[model samples]
Target: MMRKVFSIIIFVFMLSIISTAYAKKVNKEINVVISVDKNRVEIGNHIRLTVGVEGAFDTDIPELSVPESFSLMYGPSVSTQTTIINNVVKVFRGFMYGFSPSENGKFEIGPVTLKYKGKRYTSNSINIEVVERTPFESTIDEGTDRSGKRVDINKMVFVELVTDKAEAYIYEEIIQSFKLYFQKGLPIDDLDYVAASTKSFLAEKLGDERRYEEVRDGILYNVIELRTALFPLVSGKIEIPPAKFKCNIIIRQQRNRGSMFEEFMGGGGRRYPVERSTEPVKLLIKQLPEVDKPEDFAGAVGKYTMDVLAKPAKVKIGDPITLSINIRGEGNIQTIGEPLLAPDGMNNFKDYDYETKVTITDRGDGIRGEKLFHKVIEPQSEDVDFIPGISFSYFDPDIETYKTLTHEPVPIEIEHSDIETPIRLSLESAGLAKGKVKILTKDILPLMTDLYSFKNQGVAIYKRPVLLSIIFLIPILIVVACVYVQRQRALLSNDVGYARKKHAMAHAQKHLSNARGLLQLDNPPEFYATLAGTILKHIADKLNVTSASVTSDNIYDILEKRGVSNEVIKGLRQCLESCDYGRFSSGQLSREQMESTLETAEKVIVQLEKQL
Candidate 1:
């Protein structure tokens, strides 16, 4: 017994020593690392710095105070790495910071300090030489990328205003498109545009569309396009001001310094930070010349001819007439303003209907198109009307002058000329009626014609018995029902299972509808999301389980116990997987796959309903 007591004391003492040693080691392990690619900086330029903490037990790095000469352009984004080897765990935390020098000078970037485990650690001071940017200066390339290529990062992000026609007349329309191009391997979050030319230009974002890909030059780029319809407010040189935009470009970093480990560990690097668009761009806009301008010019800028085509040159009064105004043009057809028509020829027309059709295709020099305007008119009068010749004026930019084209007049021969029957007027004067012509309102004495109407205006009163009877009977019936015994047990008891089935079927149809719409749009992500959400909600409702508790495992167990077929269960799992992948991962499903998934979901829901 004494020897056992001694052994226990020795073991306890050993444990205490081991714990003390660990405590000391933790107290001394505080680290801060600062690194940069260059010792120099410049105005409107950025330099990257990486701060790391090597060994801190349950402690975070202290907040850093940046110098006045440097501006913190971006993070301080943090990342952590953990390793377990031989049953020993080690965690390393890293923070990346970007600094842009405010002006050209010699700047000191720290003595950045960190306190951990009751100890303070300071990084080595770094002196950066900031130089003024020359007229032709380039930013740091950050070395050749993984593809051994460098892109002009400055040019990758810029705003450009492109006009289809630089010179357009005062009332003419110019198609202006704004485009943004990102460099290879660059991903941007969103774009915010400011500083428009006010009411002078009608600017609008054409479509919420974007595309990203690696170009032939080994640069990954994202391109966005915005369009606007610009009509010059004035006639002279109109300058389109620079449009400023703020774009968030994803900044990426290497995980383990090189490619071999990244490819092997599936680390594949990560987007560790972000950079924003830096500058705005300007465009020189010129207005069309007023020389030789036509007095009746309709602000057209292309070569065009006008033609009036009528369905029927001669028709009845009620017949419909389709008068097509065809303006075949070669330039700025899509930007044509609202067309106006003179209504003098269309008088008495009940309804005036018009439609515009534009077709574009590759023709000769570039893309060109023709637009046709069709107007349907219905005349209400019987008189024959004439559609006089219409004149269309357009600026012929090729010849540096304006020209007016006239459509030939069209005459309509109305077959219903006799629809208005003429009244006959008889001239049988000097008859016996001429001597008897007298005024009737001259207050003559009442004759035999007025003897029957003695008094036609007299007030009379009569009481109706129907309204009084209803008013007395409704309340007497209420008093009679107060003494009657209500049938308390006749109502059917609520069937919980039937209610569940009813709700399940209703919700299932809702899910099916959502999936159908998503499928029609060919959106795989939304299709799968709606499809999976609908099925899961229906199952939860049918099984009497709360939606929050409907995990994949829980759902599978419930469905299997409910005698759901293996095939249907398998399809449910497939749908869930597809949704998970398309939503959380980079897997994209084809249109056929989306349609199949939608159909399969419906079948599975129907089968589940059968089992229930």
Candidate 2:
């Protein structure tokens, strides 16, 4: 019994020694360090800044100073990590920030300072280089990957801005294509596209997005292409701003679990955000050539053909005729002006303003459509034999000349009125004497002499209370309705912020319903995308800002400034992060998880609506 007791004492003493050693390791010296994901970045691109603290449990948030040229997009996302190895314990905590540079230059990010245990700790500063163009653009011809292998940037991911022609005449159709290329089998999601600004042109989307595969630099890649038809409004060197998009790429990492069950389950993954932009495009717009230009040119620039049809070939003098003129071809159909009446046809008939109808068809390659004009003409004289032909003149940019299309005159026969008018006779010519007429018939009954029988034949409707009330109420209602309608119109026209705020709830609900439908379809990616967009859009509408500008980093501050509670903001952040995980991660969520996420989103949005 004494031996067993001695053994117990030995075990207890050894455990105490081990525990003390572990405690000492856990209480290691505090160290802080600052670093950036990339030292070199392009203007308008984002960089990640992280400040990590080692062997610290309680520390104040770091105070970071960024250069004037850089702006804080979002951050201070907190992360914690703990590990135990060989009887040693280590603890780490980090605060991350996302920043974008507004100007191009070399700048220092920070020498972040943190306070812990009544002591101050300073982190090393990081240097960054911000260039006007992306590294991919400058290094396309010569670049080495991290593995020291020469690789083309286009093989991984890139964007291209292409135009059908570099130069075009004013009002000519120019097809602009924005294409995104990524390596085959790449996992990407949460795409936010920013279209190029075409303020100096009239632009129309050609069709839906097109997806296909192509080989570039002997590497296979998947491509998404969007096309737009742009018609230059002015003649000069016009610049189209670069188009941009942000997306998240999923990277799967394997884990050494040392167990078959854990290995079978799967490895985890992370999302890396990426932003790409196309180079700005420049186009020279020339004025339509003046040499050999048609006098009646109505600024129409495209290939076109016109057909004229006049109905009612047979008509009487002063009768009306309908002229149907159809101008159809490939071009800017909406801008085609009305054709003029022929001089020969104008003298013999009177014409009225023509009614116009335009139809556009997008054939995926270009813009093709037709414009129809309905004109009414009336014959004024019997000598008119045929309806005059109509002429349409337009400048054809392909041939670089003016062309006039003329239709043959429509033949018609006119007949004079055959009905004769009856003659009127005077009383004297009729030989009938005019005098005081005698009674034609006797009254059926003698008039009542009693005064009671002569009571008011009809009741006075104006004296009735209900009728008077209705009559007075109608005009008041009309005036109120008129005022209400005018106020709504004015608000919609002038106060965009008010309009958006008023409709924000409805728009959010609509998107939610769409997301729910997507959920039923078992498309988690699309559902999450829709839900995320709805939340961002709702806040943007309330704040009168663009949805693309909102991010997790800035939304907290944005909401807090408007007096939102921390609890609600945290809930929103969780919802956003869940949606992002659902979008880019390779793992599929269970139905129950998806439903819970959806419910949480609804609840948070409801809370936001009330506060906002």
User: What's the TM-score of each model vs. the native?
Assistant: 0.40, 0.49
Q: Name model 1 segments beyond 4 Å from true.
A: 1-159, 164-168, 190-195, 204-220, 253-292, 315-324, 328-386, 414-612
List residue ranges in candidate 2 displaced over 4 A. Answer: 1-155, 256-267, 418-612
- CA lDDT for candidate 2: 0.78
RMSD of each: 24.1, 20.2
lDDT of 2 by residue, 85-183 (tens): 444678899898999898888888668888776788887777788887534642322212222222224346689998999999999999999998876
Q: Write the per-residue lDDT of candidate 1 for residues 283-368, one digit (tens) a residue.
A: 33456667777566656776776767888877777778887877776665665543455556656565465688876542333325
User: Model 2 clash pairs?
Assistant: 74-553
Error of 1 at 592 (Å): 13
How good is model 1 by TM-score?
0.40
